[model samples]
Target: MAKITYIENGGTEHHVDVPTGLSVMDGARRFTIPGIDGDCGGACACATCHVYVEGGWAERLPPMEEIEHDMLDFAFDVKENSRLSCQIKIDDGLDGLIVRTPPRQY
Candidate 1:
């Protein structure tokens, strides 16, 4: 399992142990992390699961696909580090990943 840290906009952090091979959004949703709604159910159709990979983690993640990139544009508070959690598949390399959620989901 990998350890994922979800930091809310107000600075609250939720740590979860996620099984490898699952999507980051699934882990957040399973743990009930407040900021990631995952409205599209990991289909890459919605931006509600938007989050930002803190610091160097962004470089470690795989490049976003065109669909994910387009959906991210609809997310609130998009930034250089922004990503759709649904698009990130968890693995051994992603252990201890930290992602920060935006203040708003819309």
Candidate 2:
């Protein structure tokens, strides 16, 4: 399992263990971590799973595919670090991943 930290807009933090092969969105959903709506249920269709990867973890993540890039366009407060949590597959290498949710989804 990989450990992931999720931060809400007001700075609330949730630490979760994400099993390998599941996505970060899965971890948030499993723990009912507030802020990640995951409207599309990990289909990579909606950007409600949007998050900003921080603490240098962004570089460790795989480059976003064109589909994910286009999807993020619909997210709130998109940033260079913005990523759909569903697009980030949790693995041992991502043990200490950290990300922050935006103030709102829309």
Candidate 3:
């Protein structure tokens, strides 16, 4: 499992141990983290799982795919670090990854 930190827009943080092979969205749902609704159930079909990769983790994550990129267009307050949580799969390499949720998801 990898330790992932999810920070809310208001500064609340949730640290969770996400099992390998699961998406970040899955971890959030498992832990009941707020701000990530994951309406598409990890299908990358919606923008409800939007998150901002913090620190250098954004560069460390795999390149964003076309589907996720397009989906993000529907998210609120998108930034350069913006990403769909469903597109981020957990692995040993992603240990200590930090992500911040937007103020709201649309």
Candidate 4:
């Protein structure tokens, strides 16, 4: 399992042990972390699970696909490190991954 740190907009942090194969969105949902609604599940169909990958983890994550990139257009405060949590699958390589949710999900 990978240990992921989820930071809320206000700086609240949640450390979760997310099993491999599940998406980052899944981890947040499993732990009931606020700020990540994941309304469409892990289908990458919505921007509710938007987050900013922190530190060098952004470069460590796999490249964003066209679908996720396009979907991010609907997210609030898009940034160079912005990514759809549902599109980020957990693995041993991402053990120390850290992500922060935006102020608003709309």
Candidate 5:
């Protein structure tokens, strides 16, 4: 399992043990972590799972695909580190990964 830190809008942090090979969105959903609505599930059709991947952890993630990029365009408060949690597959190497939920998921 990987240790994932999810920061909510009020700056509250929820640390979860995420199983390897599952998407961050799935992990969040499994733990009922707020802020990751995952409105379209893991279909890559919604940006509700948007989160800002911190610089150090960002580099460790897989490159975003065109579809993910397109979806991010619709997210609120998008930043250089913006990513869809559903697009980020967790792994053992990603232990201690930190991601901040956007102010608005829609």
Candidate 6:
């Protein structure tokens, strides 16, 4: 399992042990982390699972696909490191991954 830290808008942080082969959204759900709605589950259909991956960590994740990029248009506060948590797969290599939740979703 990987230890992923999710920081909420108010700086509240949640650290969860996310299992490999699951999406980052799933990890948030497991811990009931606020701000990660995951409205479309892990299908990447909704932008509700949006998150901002911390700098340095974004480079380690896979390049965003066209669908993910398009979906991000519906997310609030989109940044250079913005990503759909549903599109992020947890793995041992991401043991200390850190992500930030937006203030709100569109």
TM values, all candidates? 0.97, 0.97, 0.98, 0.98, 0.96, 0.97
lDDT (C-alpha, whole model) for all candidates: 0.92, 0.93, 0.95, 0.96, 0.93, 0.93
Superposed Cα RMSD, model 1: 0.7
Candidate with the greatest lDDT versus the true structure: 4
> Mind giving the per-residue lDDT tens digits that candidate 1 earns over 1-106?
8999999989999989999989989999898889999887888888999999995899999999989888887899899999999999999999889999998897
Worst 10 residues of 3 by lDDT: 38-47
Model 5 whole-model lDDT (C-alpha atoms)? 0.93
Per-residue alpha-carbon lDDT of candidate 5 for residues 6-83, written as tens digits (9 for 90 to 100): 999889999999999999999999999999999999999989999999748888788999999999989999998999
Q: Is candidate 2 or candidate 5 better by TM-score?
A: 2
Model 1 steric clash pairs? none
Better of 1 and 4 by lDDT: 4
Q: How far is candidate 6 from the true structure (C-alpha RMSD, Å)?
A: 0.8
Q: Write the per-residue lDDT of candidate 4 for residues 1-106, one digit (tens) a residue.
A: 9999999999999999999999999999999999999999889898999999998899988899999999999999999999999999999999989999999998
Clashing pairs in 6: none
Off by over 4 Å in 3: none
Candidate 2's residue-wise lDDT over 48-98, tens digit each? Answer: 999999999999999999999999889988998999999999889999999
Ten-residue region with minimum lDDT total, candidate 4: 55-64
Query: Candidate 4's error at 86, in angstroms?
Result: 0.2
106: Cα error in model 2, Å: 3.2
Model 6: which ten-residue window has the lowest total lDDT?
A: 37-46
Candidate 6 regions exceeding 4 Å error are none
What TM-score quantifies how close candidate 6 is to the native fold?
A: 0.97
Number of clashing pairs per prediction, in order: 0, 0, 0, 0, 0, 0
**Can you tell me which runs of candidate 2 are displaced by over 4 Å?**
none
lDDT of 6 by residue, 1-94 (tens): 8999999999998888999999999999988999999988889888999999994899999999999999999999899999999999988999
For each candidate in turn, give its C-alpha RMSD to the true structure in angstroms: 0.7, 0.7, 0.6, 0.5, 0.8, 0.8
